[model samples]
Target: MAKKETVWRGLIAACGLFLILLTVSIGVFLCYKGLGTFTLYKHSVWEFLFSSNWNPADDFQGGGQVGAAIFIVGSVSICLLALLIATPFSLAAAIFMAVISPRVSNRLLQPAVEIFVGIPSVVYGWVGLTVLVPLIQKIFNLQYGYSVLAGGIVLAVMIFPTITSVSADSIRNIPLQYQEAAYGLGSTRWQVIRRVLVPAARPGILTGVILGLARAFGEALAVAMVIGKMKAFPTGILSPTNNLTAAIASDMGGAADGGEYNIALWTMALLLLVISFAFILIVRKISSKGVRER
Candidate 1:
């Protein structure tokens, strides 16, 4: 039995090592493809990143360009818009379920939230296209089905569950005595929440916002459905736009045959990795301060 256990442990370790190696291999492959865009025929990295034009037919020798700032602006704007729409709603929902009405913790409300979380993003897109788009058009009198406003709204719905679940867990983890102390101080429910509970849970709340932003930034299918997938700089909240992820995902199939187009797609993926890493670093910095305070 001892020998069998040893063998099994070794097998598990080997599998883990293989998984780690596979992940590293993929990162290296992506890096290789990414560096291809830095070559002689390729546009300067700054020009590629800051330029708003994306004409694949234009060659370096032919004086053509592929600017990505427009896509970055669209993605960042969408993320901020989703954060604005989702933050208050998710935080309020989380606090209500966690502290205000603990009775609803495992009841119908909980299950409904789980159901919302389980619904696929594609379904959200379909609903947005079929329902929200028409509603917005009638209300705002828009000419088109695809617009940044519609995309932001759809992304808000997609990321709402993520924020709420994380925030609720954070609030729930706080000791009961925290609330008791507020009550002992003659604080009303709203006052306790506003002054004590919410402040104490700010770190978690910020994390939820970060998660929601990350989700909104990387969301492809839902946004692509309503964002009009245009490659140009967005003119307004009601105008069509495409995010970094959507641009790459939408164009990769045709570009996969190998050329500057393929290299550009990989470069976009690298940009996304850098952006996500930067956000995570910010999260870590916030977490460190919270640790110091504690």
Candidate 2:
């Protein structure tokens, strides 16, 4: 028994160490490759981060003007919009599934949602391209439908299952005694949910939201298809734009190995890594606050 226990513990420890090592390795690699762009091209990090001009044409063969401000803004806008669209629906679904309609949730709704998760991103993109894009254009009387709005809508659908699943799990984990206490205090079901359940599950819900945001930020294929891939600052939600992930996907292949363009792509990847880390930190902070409140 001791030997088996020791083996299992070692295996778990090894897995944890491997994950840590992998994360550190990726961060180091991105920093090295990303910083190389500034050194090789003599471009200021400030310009790369703040400037909207992303003209890699001149730098195709060598170092040229490369700025990612527009892509960064577009990425932020799309993610914000997606969260706005998804959060309310996801929360409602979670509440219904965990509190109001467990039988239906288990028998039908969860399976339906799982099906959505199983569908390929490319299929979602294609549907957006063929259906949502044209509908948006026609309704809004725009020349093109491929815009930030389209991307946000598509991304909302993609992250819906993630947010809903996590939130449902969080709500379901709430102690039954909490609900009974609320009822004893003359609280109704809705009131109990609003005051007791939601507050208790807040940390987990926030974690789910952040995870969904990460998915929205990192998504490449689906957003790329509907966002028009324009290398400019988004003037409005209706405007066509590009994102960091899309820019990397579309431009990386054309860049020669060890070239300025390649390095610029690496820099975008580094920015993505930074954004992901920030989200993780935010999750930790929320978790800590929840513990303190308890």
Candidate 3:
């Protein structure tokens, strides 16, 4: 029995190590492939990262036209919009769940949230296209059903569950002794949550928001379905926009293998990765500060 248990533990450890190595290998491989495109184009990496016009047709030989500024702006705008919509709702819902009533939280609200999170982004996209687009078009009389506003709305729905779940967990983790101390000091429930609970959970909340942003950045199918996918810069929330993920999804198939167009798509992917890593780093810093203060 002892020998069998030891073998099982060894297998579990080996499997975990293998999974970590595999994940790192995949990241390195993608980074290398995406970075190779810039070198092939013969332009400085800075130019590729910052330029505004992305005319792959002008760079058949991989010479120029490597720009991502407009795409970056749209992505940032859409994510900001989603975050603006999701953060308050998620935080409030989390607070309600954590402090108000566990019966309501554990029975009804939590399951509802889990269900929302499980709903496919594609399904949300379809609903946005069919229901939201028509409503917006009727109200605003836009030329297109697909717009950045629609996309942002869809993204908000997708991100809500992520933010709420993480925020709830963070709030739940706050020490009960802290709550006792606050109550001992004659603090009201609202006062304790607004002051003590939220501050203590600030790092986790930020981390959740960052993770939600990352998720929104990588979402392609849903955004592609609602966003007009136009190459032009967005004029407003109602304007058609093409984010980095959408651009790649829209153009990848038509792009010739080893061609400038394909290379440009790869470059866009690398930019997305950089943005994601930056958010992760920021979250880690906030978490570190929270720990130091604690």
Where does the lowest 10-residue lDDT sum fall in candidate 1?
A: 56-65
In order, the Cα lDDT scores of the candidates are: 0.81, 0.91, 0.85
Ranking by TM-score: 2, 3, 1
For residue 162, model 2's alpha carbon misses the true position, in angstroms, by: 1.2
Best by lDDT: 2
RMSD (CA, Å), each prediction: 2.5, 1.6, 1.9
How many residue pairs clash in each candidate at the backbone level?
A: 1, 0, 0
Tens digit per residue, CA lDDT, model 3, 49-135: 677877775345765576777788888888888889889999999998888987789999999999998898889989998999888
Better of 1 and 2 by lDDT: 2
If candidate 1 were superposed on the true structure by all CA atoms, what would the RMSD be? Answer: 2.5
Please give the lDDT score at residue 272 for candidate 3: 82
Off by over 4 Å in 2: 57-63
TM-score preference between candidates 1 and 2, better one: 2
Give the per-residue Cα lDDT of candidate 1 at 181.
94
* TM-score of each candidate structure, all chains considered together: 0.90, 0.95, 0.93
Supply the TM-score for candidate 3.
0.93
Candidate 1 C-alpha error for residue 52, in Å = 0.8
